[model samples]
Target chain A: MTEATFDACIQAILKGDKQGLRDIYDAYLDYIYRIVYGVVGSREDAEDITSEFFIKLWQQADRYKAGSGHKAYLATIARNMAIDHTRKYKKEVLESFTQESDDDVVIEPVSSDNTEAEVIEDIAIKEAIGKLNPKEQQIINMKILSEMTFQEISDILKCPMGTVTWRYREAIKKLRRYGYYEES
Target chain B: MKNLEKEYKDQIDREVPDLWSRIEAGVDAYEAEKKAAGTAPSSTPVTETPTNITPIRKKNVISIITRITAVAACVLILAATVKVTQRTKSESAAPAADAAMSEMPQNTNEPENIQHAEEASEATEAPDYISPITEAEADAEPSNSYKPIAGADSDKNASPSLSPSESAVIKDPVTFDDARDDLLPQLEALGFKLIKDFVFEDSVDKRSLSDDVISDDIDIRVASFTDSKTSDKYYVVYTVNDDGAADILIVRKADNTGDILYTNPSYKNK
Candidate 1:
């Protein structure tokens, strides 16, 4: 839904309109679910987190400001909730991470005649990313996959913006060494 | 800032979408459970007062009650004072009259005269004492008053003291339930569904008040629920006091009833 429409729905819900809540769920559930999935890295975990996110929305619906993008605000809430879940269930999350192999982490290559080349490129990049320290790997992933700005990455990782820039440079240097990118 | 850094940034951006999609799916699953449990179709009205009361006729009813109590107290006090004064006068006058008669030249047959004078004084003083009380009551009547007692004395030649709007608010509490019930069908016809039934309470903060005037009314609160599945919408119900104006607020869900996305107010009802 358009931001204007989403805002209207939020106002309705804040006013204690049940239909507004239902409408919001039906309209933007996929977009919100996707954001939660991105952070939690598991369908089951994402589903659970998404549900919690909605409940939080209902509880705090009145706090939403009209002009602010509702989707972005909700995404931030979902990300925070997912992080909280990860912290609470750290052991399970770590086990799940260890079980998933490099191949499991990589996306299935699209049907192109150059699929083998793309797969090789993905493998090389993934291995190079894996070789970095965990914090460096997170910085790279958040910048690249999450499309977060340097400032946003710094905020998310609880580091300075300069540190985020330095980390990305180091990760990119490692990727280049692994033949994942051309050296300039 | 370097050339190599620039090259890598381009590559990362090109490859990010696929990875992001996988990450997003994982988050969706995690949130679904919480959303299911929290979105239990509550029928409570949402309000700033925390009492789930849709702002309506509660204020009017409270004002009427206050007016009635104030008027009743004034009437009672005046009546009691008049009764006490009459009793004391009769008690003192009996002795004084007997003393005066004792001083008179042996008029032993004056008992009939004394009885007739007592009766005549009582008949004259009763109306005189009551007239002022009635006039004071009329003068003390509330501005824009709507008390039903005003109507009760109409045929008895009492003044028409209540304004139209005041009477409407006073009479509203009795008809409020029926009026609200009757509107349910109209609300349903307008596409509202009933959800969970719950009572709401409002709290008063003394520190939040700037004035010393305290309210003594207890607010009665209720909630109604409805969903627009086809439009993927939900509405919060509210009714205004003047003209019984009804409003429904719209909300949309994020995914599978997991999260609710509040569409901005500007886009609602369109």
Candidate 2:
């Protein structure tokens, strides 16, 4: 998970070390997939994008210059691929799901022992996050979902550091207002 | 700040695991496919120099140079023809206008009024003559003539998107040329061919402009070369912003499976 270890795996991948590729995959696959899923908003699309991202990795493995945070780099690739997939298919996806009411739309609830409680909490939190401006939602997603640092998020969002910080704070306040962090 | 950061991090931790798993499976599948294609596997050892690699580099440089020259030649020819036509029009038309002016302007009594009327008439006729000439000149210009050179030139000025340390791996003096040369054809095989140079003003933030943004931005250009036969001719151009470390924006196209075919990551116009 450390940057050094990750870089080593990348080096190994470049050297055509199959085990290295697997190791890199094992370490960060979940992180990359989740980030893609967050953007694509569907498991199927997320799956496709994730696959494409890695295929890209294989093709351009030589191009992944080291010292660029390898995991961050991979995450970025996944995120872009997912977004592109969504854009390409947005019209079809929107039309297919148009029949479903907002209230009927069910997102997977967080996994925990308190399934019912967590689902209620998640709904409240998601709704609160949804209420925020689009920029805020993006900020939260970049910071939380993508695990991008403030600086990285700032670069991606093309905003001042202070602005990223403020948006993150505001989004958190809104989510907390919905009792997102209230221990049952 | 620390507390808030921690809280946000925890929230992300809770939401991310499930989604991450799905992406992992997708990457794995993609990697598996590349292995089957005999495209350099990620794990391919770098120790031995492959004999086939030499021709690929040479071919890439030649093709890129040829594409550039061809586009430049087309533009120059178009410009020359336009100039010739403009000269002919001016030669034939100016005398006619001058003769008409001389025949009408002998009286001095109403000089101001006459001059005003003549000037007004010339204003109306001027645009009429000039507009068509301009349009004709524009029409004579080959549309795709500027494309390849623009891409090639932009590649020269593009910022190094990868950090120095990262770039160092390929910077071995002996190998840099080889590496640069190797890059283009590998890209070509992916189904992209350089077409034009473009400057993208990325107002999107650094966080939002993740590698995904990089890929998607490139894909937008890729999608434009819509020919099914050129599906294998993927082309990409990339350039870094002059002022910021805002990573280079590459325009790329891919083959049918959407694999990247061409990339010029350093295609910023100077």
TM-scores for the candidates: 0.32, 0.35
- Once superposed on the true structure, which residue ranges of model 1 sit more than 4 Å away at CA? A15-19, A22-44, A83-133, A145-147, A173-184, B1-270
TM-score, candidate number 2: 0.35
Cα lDDT, model 2, residue A28: 69
Q: What does the lDDT come to for candidate 2?
A: 0.47
Q: List the candidate 2 regions with Cα displacement exceeding 4 Å.
A: A91-139, A147-174, A181-184, B1-43, B46-270
lDDT of 1 by residue, B134-226 (tens): 223334542222223433554322323434344344323234455455334333322233323311212423212211111111111223233
